[model samples]
Target: MFYYYEKDQKILASERNDLPYAQGKPIPGAPIYYLVEGDPVLGRGSFKVNHPGQLKAPHGLEVLDASRLPEFPLDATLSAALEAGQLTAVNTGQVGWESVLSAAPSAGKKRLNILAIGDVGSTLLTGLKLLGGGVLSSIGICDVSDQVTARWEFEMGQINLPWDYNAFPDVEVVPVEKLFDCDVFVFVASRGIPPVGSKVKDVRMAQFETNAAIVKQYAKMARAANFQGLWCAVSDPVDPLAKTAYLESNKDENGNWDGRGLRPEQVQGFGLGVMNARAAYYAKRDEKLSSFLTEGRSFGPHGTGLWIANSIDCYDEEISRELTQKTVTANLWMRELGFKPYVAPALSSGALSILLTLRGEWHCGSVFLDGVFMGVKNRYTPAGVETELLPRIPDQLFGHIQEAAEELKRVL
Candidate 1:
C-alpha cells in the first residue's frame, strides 16, 4: 500500500497490487510510500519532481510516523530493487532521490585527516591513533598552527611499544592544501568557544556563528579540490555546521548555487553518538530504566532539542523526558565542576562513532535529511545511507523527532 497527502488534508492510499504499471510513475509534488505488508517506513518515501511549467499544485510533503505501521521485511526483491535504483527512500519534503545505492569500497585501511588540534581535536586524535589501528592506514593531522600539528606527531609517535608496534597506524602532520586528500576529513576547527565559568546554558550555539564562518572556507576548499570523501563535522552545533559545509561548498564565488562539491549524504554530524552514550550512562544508574541499555535510541541535534527514547518496545514518555534532559545537560555537569567537557565527546562521538561508520556498524549520528541535518541511528553501507526502520515508533517520540527537525530547519 502507498499513501500520500493532498492539498485538502486528505490521504490517498493505494495498494501496489492494484495500481497498473502505467500509473506507477509517482505524482509530481506528492510523496509516495510503499507498505511492506501494512506498515509504513517512518518519514521515508519517494517524491516526484513537478514539471517546470505546471501549475502550482498541492505540496504533499510532511513527516509521517510509521510506529503503528506493520513491519516491512527486507526481502530479496526490495534489496535488488534498491540496488538497481528502481526504488528509493525520500525524506519529507525532499524533491527527488539523489543518493543511489552502489557497491561501496571494500573494507580496508582508510586515511583519515583531522583539521585543528585543539582540546576536542587533540583528544579525538588520541582516540583515533589508539583505536583506529585495525582500519586506518594513517592519521593526517592538519592545523593552522604548525606547532600544534608537529606536537601531536611527536606525542602520538611515542605511544607505540618498540616491539610489535606495527599494529597502529602512523600519525603525520598534513599540509592544509592536502587535508582533503584522504578517505575521511574530520573538521574540528572552531572560533570563540566559551570560556569556563560562563553562565551561558547553551555553549554549542554560542560557537555556531563563528564556527559556521570557519567551516565555510574549507567547504569551498573541498570544492576547489574536487574532493570526494566523508566530510565529518565535529565542531559544536554539529548538525547546522554540517549543513553549512554542504551549502557553502556547492555555491560559486558569486554565490550562485551549483550542484557540485559534496553531496548531501557525504557530510554528516558526529554529535549524536555522545548523546546516546550519555543517555545510556543515566539509564545504567537506574535499574528501572535499564531497558535503554539495549533498546533505547537517541535522535535530533547534539545540544538543545535532543530526543532520547527510553525503549522503543516499552516506551515511557515520562522516563524518556527525564533521560533527554540528562543527556542534553550532561555537559553542564562538567562545567559546574569548573571544567570544560571534551574527552567524552571526542572519544564517544568522534573516535568511536566514526570507527563504527568505517566498520559499517549501527551508530548514532546526524545525517542529511530533506533540507536539514537531523540526528538519527544511521550507518554508511554499500547500499547507501541506511536509517533505522523500526516496527513501531511511539507517537510521542515521533512528535519529538518532527519538532527537532523543525528546530534544525530554523537554525538554517
Candidate 2:
C-alpha cells in the first residue's frame, strides 16, 4: 500500500481506482506515493516534504510488514518521471520502508555515453574520465571523426597507469549504433558556434537554431532505439536544445506527437549549473554580498533569462539583479579576453553537476516544469526529482523565474 494527498485529505494507492495517480490536491504535509511490486521493493519518485513533522501515511496504506521488503534503490530514470509529475512516493509511516526510501541507495555503477569531442566535449570528457570513477563503471565515446574518438580513447587510457588501473573508469570508442546503450547519453555535439573573434553578444543563444537541428537527429535515434537512459543536453542554449530533444523524440516521422519516445523529464539541460557556479564566483568576490555563499540560489534558463537571488531569506532586488547580470554575462568576459568560454561550463555544468546527480547530491540544473524545461536546485532520489522548496520565495525572484519560463516557452 502507498499514500498520497488528495484535496488536503490523505488517500491510499489501493483506495484509488487510478492506478497511475495524477497530481491531485496536495496534502498539507504528505509526499505523493507510487507503489510497484518487483524484486527491488523501491519507491522511485519525487516529492517535497516541507512539513516533516506533519508527515504521515494515509489510512489503509500502512505496511505492517515492511521488513520483508527489499532495499529502496535510487533509480534516475524513475526520478525523471517524478520530475515530470509522472511519479510520487510512499508514506512516511510505512515501517522500515520509510528509512529505506529515505536512504535512496545507489542504483549501481552507470554506463555513460558521450557524443562529440570538441572543445567543450573534450574538456568534459577529461573531467568525467578523471572524476567519474565512483559512480561510472565505464564511458563510451562517439564522434563524427574516427581519429577524434581514437585519440581520446588512447589518451584517456593512459590516465590510469597499470598500477593504478582502478583510478578511473575505462573509456572506449562506441559505434554510433551503440550510443544509446548506456545509463546516461550526453549530447555535446553542436554546430555553428560563433568564432572566437566574432562579436556575438549572446554566444549561447546564437547557436540555438543550428544546435536544435542537430539535437533533433539524436532525439529521433533515441526514440527509434527506445532509449531508457537520461538524455542530457550540454550544448549552448542548453535548455531550449533539451526541449527540442524531448519534443522531437516523441514525434513521428511526419512530425506528429505520438508519445512513443522520450518523456519531457527524461531530457535535462546542463547549462544552469555553470550559471549558478558563476553566481557563486561573483558572490565570493564581493564581500557585501557574501551572504549569497550560504543563502543565495540560482534559477531559470542558462542564458539572458537566468535568475540569481542574493539570499532567499533576505532577498534584495537590487543585489539580485546585479548578480543575475554578472552571472549571465560571465561568458562574455572570456570572449573579451580572446578565449571561448568552455572550461568552466564543461567542468562546472557538464562534469561536476553530472557527478553530483549520480551521487544524488544537491546541484543546479534545468528540469521539466509545467510545460517548459526550467532550471532550479534539484537532486535525484529514489522518490524522484526533488526540487528545493523554500518556505517563502521572494516575489521579485519568483517573477524572474516565471518570466524566464515564459521566455523558454517562446523558443519551441
Candidate 3:
C-alpha cells in the first residue's frame, strides 16, 4: 500500500507508480482515507471503508482488484479508525472531491425548507416542528397556494410549550424563489395520487410520471440558484425522483450534460424508513417473524419493488417472502379503510429520517448505488456519505436487492 498527504490529510492508495498526485510515507496513528477511483455512473460512490466477507469493484471503477489486497495481519489502527468512522474511501473521480477534503465538518443547527403544504408535507412539518429544535434553526414552508402555506404557518406556530415559546423551531412561510436558501431542501410537492377508493394498487408508482415532472422544475431552479444543501425527496416514488433531481440539475439550458449541479451524495430519497418501520410493526405480532425486529433490513423502492429481509444471519426465504409482501402492501391496507396512508410515512420516512440525517446518525434512505438510487442503511459524515457494509448478505436477499435496482433503472 502507498500513502499521500494533501493539506495535512493522509490518503492511502494501492499503487505508487503513475499516480496523478504526489506520494508520501504512511503516518502512524493518524486518521487515514483510502484513495479510490469512482465511476459516477456505476459506482458505490464514496463510503466508509469496511471489511466484508466478499468485495467486488463497482462496475467501471476498478483500480487494484479487491482479491489482491492483503488478508492476514489486518491493520489494527485502520480497523479502530473504521470503527470510529474516521476511514473513508475518497472518490477522487467525483466532481467536487477537492472541496470535500478541505471543507470543515458540518456542525451547528441547520435551516430547513419544505416545498408544498399537502397532506404528507403538513404531517412531516408537524413532526419536525415538535422534534427538530436541537437540529434545526428554523423551518421554511412554501407552496403554490398562499392560503395553504399561511394555514400551515399559523397551525405550526400554535404548537409550542406555554413556558418556552422558543423551544421549537419557528415555522415561516417563504416565497417560492427563496426555497433553496436553507441547509436542507425537502421536495414533498406531488400530484396524481389516486384517491382512497381508486382501483390503483400501486399508488406510489402511479404518481411517478407526474411527480417526476414536478420535481424536475424545482430541480432546475435549484441548479440556477446553485443550491448547496441536502436535497431530500419526500414525494411519492422517492427513489427515482431523487435521481431525477440530481440528473435534471446537471443539465445545461439546452439539456446538454454538465457536472456543475448537485453531487450524487447531496440528494437522498427518504422512502425506505417507513418501509423498515412497517416490517418491524409486523414482526412484533408474529413469533415466527420476530427475528426481523433485531436482525432484518428493508431494501429497494417504496412501492412494488420493495423487499424486506426476515433476518440477515438466519435468513428464511419463505418467511422473508411473506414479510416482504406484507410490508409492500401496508399502504394498501390503509386505503382499504378509506384513508390515504400518509401519516406514518410522513413521520417515519420524511421527518424522523431527515432529523437523523442532520444529526449525522445512521438512517434508512436511498442513496446512489450503481447508477440508481437504491434504498440502504446510510449516514452522512464529514468526508461524505457512508453506507453500511455488512459482514455478509444472504444470496437470496442480495438477489432481491439487485432486482429492485434493475426495476428502478427500467422505470427511470
Candidate 4:
C-alpha cells in the first residue's frame, strides 16, 4: 500500500497499480503510507517514520521499512527495491547489529576495495582496518604511491602502534587493477590537496576544479569496467566531484547526456563531516550555546564565507556571531597550531562518515538537492540518502546560504 501525504490530509494513492496497498484520505501531514494487504504479523500498515519523529500523519511506503523494521532484512527486494538495510544502533551495548537489520550483511567476510588512497584514503584505511568489521573480509588499498601503499600494507597488518589490529585484521594494499574489482570502490584520491605552502587561498575549494576533472576521468573508467558497487568519494570538494562522476559516466561518447550507466544516485561526497566538526567546536563553549554542538548546522563548502547557523531555539545574536566566527576560523587555527589539520579531517570527513554511512546513520554531508548537487546534512537509509530539512533559519543566515549556493554555481 502506498499513499501520498498532504499537510492537511491523505490526498491520494500512487497511480502505479503495481504497488501493494491502499489510498489515503485527507490528513494533516505530509506523509504517505503503505500497507501490505495481508502481512498481519508486523501489522497491515507502516507509517513513513523517517528522521526521528516529524510525521504527523506518517505514510507507510514499503521502502521506509527497510532499516527501521525488524522483519524486513537485506533481501534483494528490500535492500534494492526499498533501498534499505537494517540500521545499527549507535549504542552498541543496548543493541547490536543483530537487532538493527532483518539480517546482517553476513558474517561471511569479503575483501573491501579502495581506489586512490591519498591522505584521506589512508586515514579511512586505518579506520576500516581498525574496525575489521566482519562485513569486510580484507581491504584492497590502491594508490599512485608505492611507498605509501607499501607502508599501509605493512602497517595495517600489524597489531601495534595505535589500536588493536588483530581485532580488525583484514587490511592490505593492492594495485589499481585489483582495486576496481572489489565489493566497494572508495574513491579517496584527489587531483590536489595539502597545499605545499601557506599562501594558498581557499585551499579546500581550489581542489574542486582539479578534482572535478579527475572525477570525470574516473567516471569513464568505472563505466567501461561495468563497476556495479558503492562508489564513495572522500576527497575534498566531495559533493561536486560526486556529481561530476555521475555526469561523466552518463554522458554518451558523442557528448549527449542521459541518466544511465551510472545513475546520479550512485555517488556520495564526504565534505559534510568537516561542517559537523565545525558545529561541534561551537557547541562546547557553554551550556546555552551547546546545541551548536547539539543543534547547530553547517551545510555547505569548507572554504571562506561558509554557512554556519546556530539552532533557532538556541539562537542568540551574539552567541551565533561568535560561534560562526570560530567555526569558520578553526582551520586557520590548526595551521597556527603549527600542524596541517590532516588527521582530524581524515577521521571526521573520511573514516567516521563512511562508517556511519555504511551503518545507515544520519550524517552531515552533501546530497543531490534541487535536481543537482546540493549540500544538506543527511542520513543514509535502505532507500537512498535523504537530506534533512532545517526549520526556517534566521534571515541573515538564510542570506548567507543563498549566497553560498550562488557561489558554488558560478564555479560549477
lDDT of each: 0.74, 0.73, 0.80, 0.56
Q: Which stretches of candidate 1 lie over 4 Å from their true place?
A: 1-107
lDDT string, candidate 3, 1-412, tens digits: 3335544455554433566665655555555666567675445446555542112243221111233223533355555656665766666666665555554555789999999989999999999999999999999999999999989999999998989999999999999989999989999999989988998877888888999999989999999998878999999899999999998987889987676778777899999999999999999999998999989988888887888998888999999998999999999999999898999999999999999999989999988876888888888877567676665677777778878888998988
| Residues 72-156 of candidate 2: C-alpha lDDT, one tens digit per residue | 4334433344344434544322223333233333478999999999999999999999999999999999999999999999999
**284-386: candidate 4 lDDT, tens digit per residue:** 7567568676567775655555666677555566766676677767777787777666677777777777667666577766554333344556675542345
Backbone clash count, each prediction separately: 2, 6, 0, 24
Q: What's the ranking of the predictions by TM-score, best on top? A: 3, 1, 2, 4
Model 4, runs deviating above 4 Å: 1-111, 132-135, 160-166, 194-197, 286-288, 389-399
Model 4, residue 128: C-alpha shift (Å): 1.9
TM-score pick, better of 2 and 3: 3
lDDT of residue 129 for candidate 4 = 72
Question: Which candidate number has the best TM-score?
Answer: 3
> lDDT, candidate 4, residue 229?
59
The CA lDDT at 288 in model 2 is 74
Flag the better candidate by lDDT, 3 or 4.
Answer: 3
The lowest-lDDT stretch of 10 consecutive residues in candidate 1 is 52-61
Tell me the lDDT of candidate 1.
0.74
